[model samples]
Target chain A: MRVRAQMSMLFHLDKCIGCHTCSVACKNLWTDRRGAEYMWWNNVETRPGTGYPTGWEDQDHYEGGWKPDGDGITLRLQGKGKALARLFFNPALPQLEDYYEPFTHRYEDLFDAPAGDVQPTAVPISMVTGEPMNVDGGPNWDDDLGGSDIFARNDVALDGVDQTIRAQMEEIERVVFNYLPRICNHCLNPACVAACPSGAIYKRGEDGVVLVDENQCRAWRMCVAACPYKKVYYNWSTGKSEKCILCFPRMETGQAPACAHSCVGRIRYMGVLLYDADRIPEAAAVSDAELVDAQLDMILDPNDPVVIAAAHEAGIGDDWLDAARRSPLWKFVKEWGLALPLHPEFRTLAMMFYIPPLSPLVASVERELYRLELPPERQDFELFDRLDKARLPIRYLANLFSVGDEQVIERVLRRMLAVRVYKRRQSVEGVVDDATKDLLASVDMTPEEAEAIYALTTLPTVDERFVLPPYHREMSIETLNDPLAHKGEVGVGYLEPPRRGW
Target chain B: MSDTVAMIVFVAFPYAALTLAIVVTVLRWKLAPFTVSSISSQLLESRKLFWGSIPFHWGIVLILLGHLATLFFPATVAWWNGVPIRLYALEITGLALALWAAAGLLVLLYRRLTTARIRAVTTPMDLVVLIVLAVQIASGIWMAVGYRFGSFWSVGVVVPYVWSLLKLSPRPELLQPFPFILQLHVVSFFVLVAIFPFTRLVHLITLPLPYLARPWQRVVRMRHIEPVG
Candidate 1:
């Protein structure tokens, strides 16, 4: 089993508050440059909306990600021959308009303006051309469903649902949405690395961090088109594609990435997952129905003796193996089966997993009518059978996280609900009654496991959440050479400092 | 004095240009490798680029191949031109290709000049390269129209001279009889070759041709490359 250590992430969507602290932190670190104002390396997208770059999930228009040809998958953008032919004019590329025209207020104008009856105003100016422009869209234009009528109605996930159900989603009170804060998945089979004509992009084997060699990036912009999540962005000033480096510098020293570390909601979990490298093709090639299972099967149990032996043979150290065993991502994604990859149908085998957010329970007409007939004093637990009527449709979450596997979404949400109900009963009711037991039994979870899930979800320490593996390269460097050898030269400087032009 | 100038332009200058091109290209590749890209402006303005780049690339590529064919198979080209109608067809085709290339070059130049974003991103080298390209294309079109049947006469005269240069025997006098426009084409070409590695023209050698045959997914194996202590 060619075991390889993959550093992965799990986002517990249940806890995310949609505050965009991660977005601002990442922007300040990576993409806050002249040409990169349009790029959001980390963005919190409000789902049930069309996301950044307008209707990105519609593969027919944007054509990002991989397409299943027969058994194997090919990039949905274009094949090799077609790609080379269209190198000059990448028809699939998202234009500046597709992403919003980045603009900033001319704040200096407020102070510069002469005193007048009207208050001094900072005119919005396009960052690209420095011309006055109307602010039409932004990186998070649909935040909290600000422009829900147009943005939410056009979401690609809603396409497969019943027309009436789709219409119901647009209704004011019936609406449901969740925050999907995204960074690049840094997939096992990254289409960006495959599509790069310059062969500049590479996934570092040591930690599986995807990086773009800016010098070699010929501004082909193929990576921008190929990434299914649209995480790779083109910097027009430098004429190159730039993406999230996953904070490898911080990670090497056992610190969480800036975004994860700065998270206010504590939704992000970083960890190591030991996987069978040989099964990547098989896992990614599976049918959409089996995608979640295939990906899980690919993630070898770190505790397994056989897997540990294979990992050792693959040059992995004991520290990394230990980290993998202790990984919160493994428990959330595989052991507990709470987190699932976003859009596994993309066939990129996205390393980032997410726990589908639980929505408020819908009180159906029958349930409410039945409640009215009975006395208020007799009402006790109304949780189990009512799960099928969650305000957010099972089909919608399935479309996003599980590729239309409604059963998968139902089970995850059921488990989450059981934990809450189980915990509330202990704290509020002061006992573990049979009603709570029946609720836990119906979802097939023990009280101990529910308690463990609850502890990790609500009360995890920073160390428990981010299980960073040992950097073998850094360790070797420290032992073989002096850590302070490069001293000032290596501390701060861009290898190839970006400039305007020749 | 004219004989000396001809020798410098035809024999000495061409050799010097080729040597400079080769040495500088290697040095730049080793030093500032990131600069070796045909950085696109399609992100800013793709509509004008489609009109400019497609015709320019396809037309120039075909025309360049045509130039190479005439030089390599001068005897075969002369034999084909022996027929009167065949000669006219060949001449008309060369002129048409030249016109097509020139038109594309004009569109590309105009786009760069007119577009605000494109003008901002453009470098001194970029403007110089475009102007140089314009001169070469304009001179070629001028020669094709003003001095007709260049494809026929060039085989007998220019072919032998160029062949002698390749054979390491200087024959600057043979090209001396050519008009100023014809000489300008040769001079502009060598200058382009000299400045090639510094401009976006380096991307000509950097196209990922292997991508057409390689697998869809690429996983870099850096394990073996690094020295493990």
Candidate 2:
């Protein structure tokens, strides 16, 4: 086993409140620059709606990610030979129109306009051309508008759901949506890295953080087409590709990424995970239905003596292994099986996992003549069967997380339901119901296990949420320059301003 | 006075261009590695570029290969030319490639001038390089058409002169008898080499050569981390 420790994340979607605080924090920290005005490194996308850059998930148009060939996978964008052929001009590249024309309100007009009968208004001007433009779209134009026919109905994720079910989802009263905050997955097998003609994008081996070497990027924009998640963005002004760096400078100093630290909902969990590096290809090569299990299998138990020996042999330090043991991501993803990688069918072996949100119980209809109120004893029994009747179809959640496998979604949701029911019983006296017991029994989860899951999910402290591994900066720096010389200068921004042109 | 002018054009000017090209290219590479790119505006407008770029690149590459073979492999060219059919085929192929490249360059120049998006990104150096390349190609085609058999004759006249320059020996007398088109082609070629490092032509040196054999995935580690002994 080629044990490698990768810093991973688990975003509990059930806890996300759809606040764009993470987006703003990441923007202020990283992308608030001349060329990167439109970039949102951490964006909170409201699911059941078209996401940022509008319909990014529609790979049929964008042609991002990997497609399974005969046995292995190939990039949906282009191969090595084809990449060179299209190096001069990438026809598949998304234009500035695909992403809205970045604009700013001309607030000067409000103050400087000549005296008039009506109050002067600020008009929007294009950031690119600096001309007055009609304000039409933004990064999150369809935020929380799940019932809208324009944006939400066009969500490509809903394509896998049955046509009838999709229509039902779009109904005004029946509309249900959850917030899906995204950052770069820093995937184990990043297609962006594979498709880069300049070999500019690469995953850091020490912590598995993917970074674009700005100096090396030739602005081919193939990374924009290759990333299944569309996390990479082209800086039109700089003529280079830019992406989420995972706030590695902050990470090195034992701090969570800007987005995760500033998250209002406390949905983000960061930690170390030790996995078999040799299994990455095998894990990603599995059939879509088995992808989740295959990826989970790659994550070795940190406490296992054999694994620990292999990890030490592979040059992973003791501190990282200790961090992996306390990792909430490990507990939520592998141990409890609550969190799952998004769109495993993309086969990038994405490191970020999401705990699918639990929707409200599905309501039932009864004829006036046959309708009867549920008795107190039967009420508890009816609650146990609510999983099959959830307002959000199992098929829909499965399509998003489990690669169209309903069984996986059902298991995670059941466990979450059991924990909620168990917590209620603990908090309120005489609230203990036979249905709650049956729900826990069906999931084969003990009361202690349910309470443990509840504690970690609902009441996790900041330290528990983010188990930061020790970054050996001294060792890393010693290879290039003297660590002592650069000891005082440890932060994100460049020491000198970046020059613009050749 | 004529001999001095010939020496300046044939020896001093060529040497100066070569020196400037080498020194500036190295300096630019060291100082501004990030900016050394073709800065392809393909993202802005690709349709015209698709029609122009492919034929232009292939035509120029084949033509350059033919020029290099004639310059460095004269014995092989002479033997091939001994066969009359092979000589005709070579001349025809070279002329076709030159015409193809000229056509492609014209289309590119039109795109650069007419397309607003491309025109916006076009720097003065970009225009100069394009014009110089066009002039050089036109002069070459003129030489091929007027002189009829430059592929064989270039070995006798241009190769010896080029060899003399490499050996740091002045041989302006040998090239002075050549036609104005041939001399203009030689001057323009050296001028192109001089401006190459300063322009988008720097991308020519930065081709991802290892990409042909590189693995699908790349894992970059901190340099300090080494395998446990």
Candidate 3:
């Protein structure tokens, strides 16, 4: 067996405070430099507003990545139709101005320019040029998504549809409007990975968190162009590109990721989820809806000795084992069907899972359907604005969280299944108590359903394997003194020294 | 006063310019936020820009290598070291690669110039760099044709004299024997260098790996709550 260890993350949208502490922490730690001014590896974009750099999702406008025309693929760019056409051809869609213009200060105005005009005591100037005036915005502008106009317009539910599933769609829209946090699904099959030409991007062997190689990144910004979600950022100064790293370094130490750790809402959950790497290709080949089967197969029993032994043998630590014992990843996934993959469509099997928001609209519609004694089959189903036609809109729900899963189209009138979005009520340190499952079962489901939910949500298998090589097997802060001890350097981590006088 | 002083400035100045270019390039590469940071949600989500940029850079790097080699080659290597067969092969191959690279550069340059966002970011300095590079490549090929070429001895003298000065030797004999055409080329090179630090040519100083490193963290943001925009 290839024996690939898989890892995943879950962000409770309800708990996210959007303080951007994570962004700043990331910036301070990594991207606080010249060319990187344009890049935000941990940027928190307000939806409904054209994200910074604007219309990033509209690939047709920018001409990035491959577009599947039925089954055939065509490059989205212009002019290179067949031959080496012209010396200068136009891109169908051009790159956008994602960052504000860099500004400088004017220091001369203080004592030199005006010359004895009361000689202003203090020179009010910008930083770059040091002149005596203020520069408008040189990158990192209006931090709060510019203003509230963008926020007021954040609700997509207001956009009424013309389809027969109008009422249900409206309901679905209402719930999403209430609160639906969307994140990188970290798909099991990331389209972004498939689209990269340089092979610079890869999903981690242990956690399955996809990453782009900075050294290999020729600043082509193709990843920027291809990701439908527009997650990647290009660094103009560094002559390369960047994106979110799921914080494997921190994870290795048994600490949650920066975002998860700093998340004030405490809605984030970090855990080791055992997945069958062998079944990935097979799962990726299945229809979007049937993808659930592939994901389910990857699930391992945490308590199983064979898996435990394998995990320990793989170099998993005690902290990780303990976390697995208490992880809600097991409870939500294997025990309950509530926690679901964001989007199964784009084919990137994202590791991030969401507890579908069952909107009041869905409840109301279900009640009405039950009252009428009519079977809610596909033929009679009202094509709700967001819900899937079958059980619910899992596919469409997936798109809300991922890039290309067409399964979202199959979902018809779906909405948020859980209320209290962005609230971090779940505990990462405590194991799920059986009494809670019994209580939930008594109120919401039959004994069998409750047990199934419990089984899915409880951490069944703990993977203690270290996907990191032996050199990384046991490391400490002291190891930094011996540069060679830092094994990441041998791999893609051997970053080029910064250019002189930088 | 000897013409050596002028020659010294002429030859020595371009290296300074090259240094400045190296600095800016390095700073841009090393300290830039995007290079060291994890992949941005914006970049990863866009598929097309990602791929288009790859070919664009390939064209750029190849062209740059060809240009660097042509501009800095030793005269002995150009003439006396006398591998007629190798020289002929190199010249032909280099010229072909240069042309291909130039074609790609033109495409990329055109993309930047025409794109609204890119154009906005592009300063006069950027345009100057492009124009200068274009001219250098064009003139290089023109001179490569073996007609009206600067003398090898002149190039040989000026290049070494300049190097000696950089090494703090300030040798005058290196410049005493060079031709006027070579002097003009040396002067032009200095002018290019004097302006290099102030332009985008500064990207050279950055070490390739750190300049290109990507973070592995995957991020998902709340719908309405973008990170303070």
Each prediction's Cα lDDT score? 0.84, 0.83, 0.47
- Tens-digit per-residue lDDT, A188-291, candidate 3: 55555554433467776545677776654544344555555556666554445567776667665555566656654555566667665556666665664566
Better of 2 and 3 by lDDT: 2
Show where candidate 3 strays beyond 4 Å: A13-217, A309-322, A362-502, B1-135, B138-229
Tell me the alpha-carbon RMSD of every candidate.
3.0, 3.4, 11.9
* Global local distance difference test of model 1: 0.84
Q: Residue by residue across B1-229, what tens digits does model 1's lDDT show? A: 3988998999998888888989988987777776777888888888878888887887787888888999999888889989989999987887787777777778889998988778867888898888998898888888888897788889977788878878999798988987888888888998999888778888887888877777666655455212123
Q: Candidate 1: which stretches are off by over 4 Å?
A: A363-383, A476-482, A492-495, B79-91, B166-168, B221-229
**What is the CAPRI rating of model 1's predicted complex?**
acceptable
Model 2: CA > 4 A from native: A116-119, A362-384, A429-431, A478-484, A488-497, B78-96, B110-122, B141-152, B223-229
Q: Using Cα atoms with residue i matched to residue i, what is each candidate's TM-score against the true structure? A: 0.94, 0.91, 0.54
lDDT value, residue A63 of candidate 1 = 86
For A1-502, candidate 2 gives per-residue lDDT tens digits of 9988788888999999998999999999888876678788888888888888788877888888888887888899888899887776677787666667678989999999999999999999877657788878888888889767998788777766777777777776678888899999989999999999889989888899999998888777789888888899987667788999989999998899988898888999999988998998888887877899999899999999999899888888788888999999889988898999988888899999999998875443465342223455544443345565666778878878988898898888878877877777768755767767777888898888887898888788999999998786767788777887777665657643454444
lDDT of 1 by residue, A4-100 (tens): 7778888999899999999999999988998999999899989889998788777888788888888788889988888898886888898888889
lDDT of 2 by residue, B1-229 (tens): 2898998998899999999999999987787777776676665666788788767887888999998998889989989998889999999999999999888898899999987656656789888988999999999999889998988888889998988998998698988987889999999999998888888888888777677689988898765244333
TM-score of chain A, predicted model 3, versus the true chain A, to 2 decimals: 0.60
